[model samples]
Target chain A: DAGITQSPRHKVTETGTPVTLRCHQTENHRYMYWYRQDPGHGLRLIHYSYGVKDTDKGEVSDGYSVSRSKTEDFLLTLESATSSQTSVYFCATTGESNQPQHFGDGTRLSIL
Target chain B: AQRVTQPEKLLSVFKGAPVELKCNYSYSGSPELFWYVQYSRQRLQLLLRHISRESIKGFTADLNKGETSFHLKKPFAQEEDSAMYYCALGDTPLVFGKGTRLSVIA
Candidate 1:
């Protein structure tokens, strides 16, 4: 519990709709990351932000986008949602490299 | 490319039995391995890191670079120990394994 919070703990939406997930951190960590958890795939990184306004793609960044306009907030957006995008999403943050990451409760999104 | 591999998808052990979750990684650089656990309805939390070499909640994992393995071990499993465990490598953006679901039966 490193003061990480993810908005929309649960969401249900339809395909082709727009969806955005928010991750807010109180620790003011410089690094933030978004990941998706699937049954057979475990956790796959979607995107990450090393600092405000600086972001990078991860292993599974396709069809997903992220922005960190502020130091305390990182947003993950899906321009057009798909059934394949339905999964439990987790947000993590760390102060420095080689440090253990603190994770948020998670957001469970379902796309129909 | 760095990759973590968890061989078992599910494992069952009776309470008080010894438990071991196998994890192997493929990395050429100096590896920073970690074990994370997620209880039902709870967020994933760090259990232990190879660099620290400390045991948390009766769990210990040793990094064997020669074998490219970092397996989590607990001498006596408890019912509460049942949970989903993930082995991860790297620091900036960890590469996690598929995860292993441990079920400790009474």
Candidate 2:
């Protein structure tokens, strides 16, 4: 499990509202990622952080923003939630680029 | 660009029968492949990796560079193996297949 923890295991919010999902890791992994899982699209990366204050956009990062102020914390925020953003979000971390990632349980977010 | 493809959306096999989950990848350079499984409402867990060359949970995957494939296989399927399996390619941002749901019926 890599001591990964995702806060707000479940959340229901209305469209246009702001929502944030937090991922905390006990291990000081250098790479952290945020991904959303949907039925047919599989898991799409939203954003990732290589180090504290260093972030990059991913394939499906249009509506998502992320921040990492410390090595152990990564935050994903939806500026304004939309119905299409409803899905299960997962956080993963890896100590190195070639190592396998360890995942957090996931946060199920429903935007109605 | 790197991509992973899983042709089957769902597969059904009887207990004690052979099982194979196909995964094909498209990458120009050396690729690292992996198989991940997610049980009902659970987080995705790594099942096996091509480089490790080790069997995990009775599952093994051999990376066929000639074919650009990494397929997971097991001699006999068990009911407990029913889950959603994903094929992934390691890159700057990992690429994942849509996923295949394996159903082991008794």
Candidate 3:
């Protein structure tokens, strides 16, 4: 287990509202990722950060955005929440691509 | 596109029985394969990787290039081994399978 923590472990928000989930790492790894876990869909990458002020959209980045302004913090935000956006979110980080990515516990978010 | 496939959604076996969790992957070039496990109320953690060639807690995964598979096997499954197991692929950002839940009964 790596030193990763996700803020707001559980959240319930209404549709049309804005929400942000934060991931903080003490490992100082260069790569960071945000993924959403749904019942039959597995874990789909939503967004990832490679460096400070650098980020990339992943396969399922439709309604989410991510930012990495500092070494220890990575943020995933939903501009406007929707019911479809509800899922268990995960954060991971690694020193490089082929290395094992350590994961945080998870964040359970529900939008009603 | 890179993808991982885990055929079984759930499996059950008695303690001391042999266990196998199948995983297949698709990618253009050489890829790194891994198995991650999560117990109840615990974070997902790495179990093993193809590159390491080492077994953790009596579990081993062999990466077969021809079949594009990395299957986890253990001679005698323990009740503690019961958990949700995920197969993932990477050379870059990872792609994961839906995961298989193993239930071991005493």
Candidate 4:
């Protein structure tokens, strides 16, 4: 276990509603990442944080934002959810770039 | 941009048989390869990395730069080894493959 937990394991919401998913870790790793998983596409990066208040966009960052106020918590938000935005979001962290990452259970979000 | 590809979507083998799961990658720079596995109803977890040059759960993968492949292999398969396996590349933000589901039947 990497001491990671993602809140709201399952959620269903309507389009145009704002949604936030929380990822909490106890490992105090320096890197945190948010990824969305879909059939045939595998896992695509959404956003990542190298440190507190330091963030960057990934391959699929449009319509999504992330925040990292502390080393253990990274939050991903969708300003306005859409049906196309529905996906299984996974949170992962690692001590350094070369090391293997540890993943959270993931949050299943559905936008109607 | 780096990309990882697992050509096989599903693989099946009997217990005690050797198993191989193919993975290929495309990257311009030095590549860092890794294999991650997700068991039934379990969170995804790291299986092994090429940098370590070590085996996990009796499975080993060798990174072949010339072929741009990092195929995972094991001498003997067990039912417990059944899981979804993904191959990833890069250091910071790894690019993942679609994943292959391996089934080890008794």
List the global CA lDDT of all models. 0.94, 0.94, 0.92, 0.93
Off by over 4 Å in 2: none
Report the error of model 1 at residue A16, Å: 1.1
Off-target runs (Cα >4 Å) in candidate 1 are none
Model 2 Cα lDDT, one tens digit per residue, A1-112: 9999999999999999999999999999999999999997888889999999999999899988999999999999999999999999999999987678899999999999
Residues B1-106, candidate 1: write the lDDT tens digits: 7889999999999999999999999998999999999999789999999999998999999999999999999999999999999999975677889999999999
* Total clashes in model 4, counting residue pairs 3 or more apart in sequence or in different chains: 0
DockQ of each: 0.76, 0.73, 0.78, 0.72
| TM-score for candidate 2 (chain B) | 0.98
Q: Which candidate is the best by DockQ?
A: 3
For residues B30-77, could you state the per-residue lDDT of candidate 2 as single tens digits?
998889999999999999888889999999998999999899999999
Would you estimate the TM-scores of all the predictions? 0.97, 0.98, 0.96, 0.92
DockQ, model 3, C-alpha based? 0.78
Better of 2 and 4 by lDDT: 2
Name model 4 segments beyond 4 Å from true: none
Ten contiguous residues minimizing lDDT sum, candidate 4 chain A? A36-45
Q: Is the docking of candidate 3 incorrect, acceptable, medium or high quality?
A: medium
